[model samples]
Target: MTTSNQKPFSYIAPGAPKVVKAGGVANLDLPILNLATNESSFGASPLVEQAIKERASQPNRYPDPASTDLRNAIGETFGLDPDLITCGNGSEEVIDGIARVYARPGDEILFSEYGFLQFPILCWRTGATPVKAAGDGLKTDVDNLLAAVTEKTKLVLVANPDNPTGTYIPAAEMKRLRDNLPSHVVLVVDSAYCEYVDDPAFTDGLELVAGHDNVIVTRTFSKAWGLAGLRVGWGYGPAEMISALNLMRGIGNVNAMAQAGAVAALKDPAHVDMVRAKTDEARNKFEADLKQFGVVAVPGAANFVLVKFPTEDTNRRAIDAHRHLAAENIYVRSNEDYGLDDYLRITVGTIEECDRVIESLQRFFAA
Candidate 1:
């Protein structure tokens, strides 16, 4: 049916459109309690708002293509060399850049079975094979990952305090993974939820990047700093890897307002600490409350909790709960696509929001 001059095109398997279940729906008749996306419920730092307002005056000019000031501020905050840092529109952009720069058409990119969904999509877009290593009880298992690696493997991505499951491996295990991977294989450690983790055993992969040339650690302002709206993220790695990413990244990828907001957000450590404390308190309370309802709350180190519901006949399955909550204008993420059919991923919201969802769940089960 195609014209002689026109070429036919189609995406590969598993390259279908993804249905993202994000929070913060607008124009609802009732007050909506959104515990779907793992965003900071406390909002961004006051300084960020001020910075954005001030930067809004210069809308006529393009942002700094190199993001010099933002990179310097990030370096100062994390004790990293500015040359080793690369700022992006978001951590997802940096991840995409990694796949584009390192993976070839036939190369393999490996991740956990339930790792961040973006990893596979990024690989598929680049014509790279996405390999999934079996997870050990919803947690990244270094042994499984090592076993899955082959000569074709070009990159490995691990999301620490991983989304949906919110589970993570310890520092020792991460080091083992890095040491075992081939020198040509780039290990990308995504620490999007690192700010919320307080476990002593957990490492954000920064130290690993310091000692290894093939390792890169990506972080985001979306989680703790509450700059998800601005879409600012940064990555730290070896100078060579940073240079490669910079070469392939779009010019002026981060806008002026986002850069200004991120710089201010980085300066305010007290604000980040406050957000972390509130998230920890709310998450702990939510898990304990879920336990009271006989729901299996998966132990997590991130800003969200995964609650496994009973079977469908009990009217407490994840799909039923999601529908019931939606009718009440309370939205939570269902994990059916992540292969966790009976579990719901609920963001750690404010105390009031948490109480509302918990009470709603109680009413759903009671009825």
Candidate 2:
């Protein structure tokens, strides 16, 4: 059935994101407060700007394909071996490398219910089926995930402090899942939001990889680091695994400016800490405010909180509230794609911005 001009069956990908956040395209009378993508309310460290300014002049040169300096900076911050770290455009690319290296047609990639939306996309990219296990409400159930593993399952993905739902399983449970999984199957722990989690029993997945050769942990600078525009992320695992990822990762995936900026960002731990504290404070206040308004909200460990709207009695449903806020030039995430039609995920913004959303939603509820 294959033809010279026809597309490969494996080339299909998921549709583009239904919500567009850039460009301020939506016409509104008020100033835009774009929080739809969970970007950091605080900008990156001042050092990052300096680094980018210096690197921007050399646009003619190619980046270091190995990302040596960036990896060294990451190693210094995390106490990891620079040799075991592999950089990518974002953690998404590392996930893609993992998927392509381990999976193929007829194989399955297991993810938790309400897992990160990108997991299915990566599965499709590798021509593997995406299998989801049941969860206990919004939290990922480790036992259900372990039980769902079958002979065809090649990889398992767990996004700690999971996106959208903003829930995370403790380290003990994550280890249990890995212990029960087959030795040949790979386990990937995505810790994109780890900087916001203060749970004593939770992990960013780095510890799990130390003793297990089959485990890889990925991290990103997009959240608390305030570097979403830079698209810098990395993976830590065994040296052999890192080698395989380098082969699959596009050459110079992380550009020269991203590398410099990420390196500078790592040097300013105080800035990241300040951002985390502020995010936590803002998220807590948002959740409490919603509760005061008789709106159901899920307590979260990440930078965003999920609020459930009353769908039965009023026209002020989640989608309606989302549009109402957007019309006021305040955008929050709507979760229709994740089958969470009744919920909205609000990224923690500055106190003033969060106050604006609260006021806007309060009016929506009253009207």
Candidate 3:
């Protein structure tokens, strides 16, 4: 009994938590130590700024639709074939393209229990069911994910060095996950925070993609490169997967400025190394300081730390701490949306910023 005037299907709106932009608060003349978003404290390279300025004069011209030069630069940096790469406004856009190309209505998209929030949103947009596999203390449990797989599953998204919790599995575990999955299923390895990890055991999904046609690895310039404002991300996969993504992605999705900035950013390895070194120093100190206050900081490989409050009334403690920090113009992400009501995800800031946060927390707890 379908009515001619009625819409075909109901639109499922996203119910995720509101992302707080610390910049907005900082703009109000507040002395804010903004750490909500996991952006690089060091800022984008000088080369990136110069590139954007250089490209500014050509604002009227359309970007290269194929993102040819940018792709080539990325491929050169990673030692991959440019033909197997596809660029997007952000990795999220590429994820959307993957869903559109590979997932159909009645299909399922699978991810870990506390994986990236975008994974489920992408699934809903593509009319696919989002399935959650249980995790082991915020870490992706490969066995749980494999067990959750059904014949209906079309895509599996794994955010290595995952956001919020910031945990990751080793390369061998990742390989095992890929090897066990059905060949028809596409496995997307989201390595947004890969550059921050110095772990020898970790792999950024390049090796898996080299041998497996069903594997795709997505990276972003938003993290260590500090080009988040430009929204540039790229994916490397088998030629067939890249082709499928390119077909669904909008032409000129990556603008001229972003392309130029990304290319320049890639050429400066020293900038990235400096940012990583600073992040490691700050993160270690911050964790140690928090532990002195009885806070259990999750040992993660990413640039952000997931801190759990030690109290029976965990949620209240977290909320109180958050409000206290906000009063001092310091911001951190509350994890209520990710079923982690008792924790806060704080980005690793500069040394002084980290010290300031630690000092503020000490006062809040002492009171």
- Cα lDDT of model 2 overall? 0.85
What is the C-alpha local distance difference test score of each model?
0.85, 0.85, 0.85
Worst 10 residues of 3 by lDDT: 1-10
Report lDDT (Cα) of residue 365, candidate 2: 75
Q: What are the per-residue Cα lDDT tens digits for candidate 1 across 1-367?
A: 0011111121112542232223444324557565777777888878998999999998999999999999999999989999899999999999999999999899999999999889889877899999999999899989999999999999999999898899999999999999988898999999999998888999899999877889999999998988887999999999989999999999999999999999999889898899889888888888888887777788878878888987746666777777667666676787877899889888888887889898978887887
TM-score of each: 0.91, 0.92, 0.91
lDDT of 2 at 265: 96
For candidate 2, lDDT tens digit of each residue in 1-367? 0012222222122532222223545444467676777778788899999999999999999999999999999999999999999999988888888999999989999998899999999876888999999888898998899899999999999999898899999999999988899987899999999999898999898988887789999999988898988999999998889999999999999999999999999999999899988887787777778875667878668878888987785677888787677666676778888999999888788877789999987887777
Score residue 155 of candidate 2 by CA lDDT.
Answer: 94
Alpha carbon lDDT of residue 244, candidate 2? 97
Backbone clash pairs for candidate 2 read: none
Q: For each candidate in turn, give its C-alpha RMSD to the true structure in angstroms.
A: 7.9, 7.3, 8.1
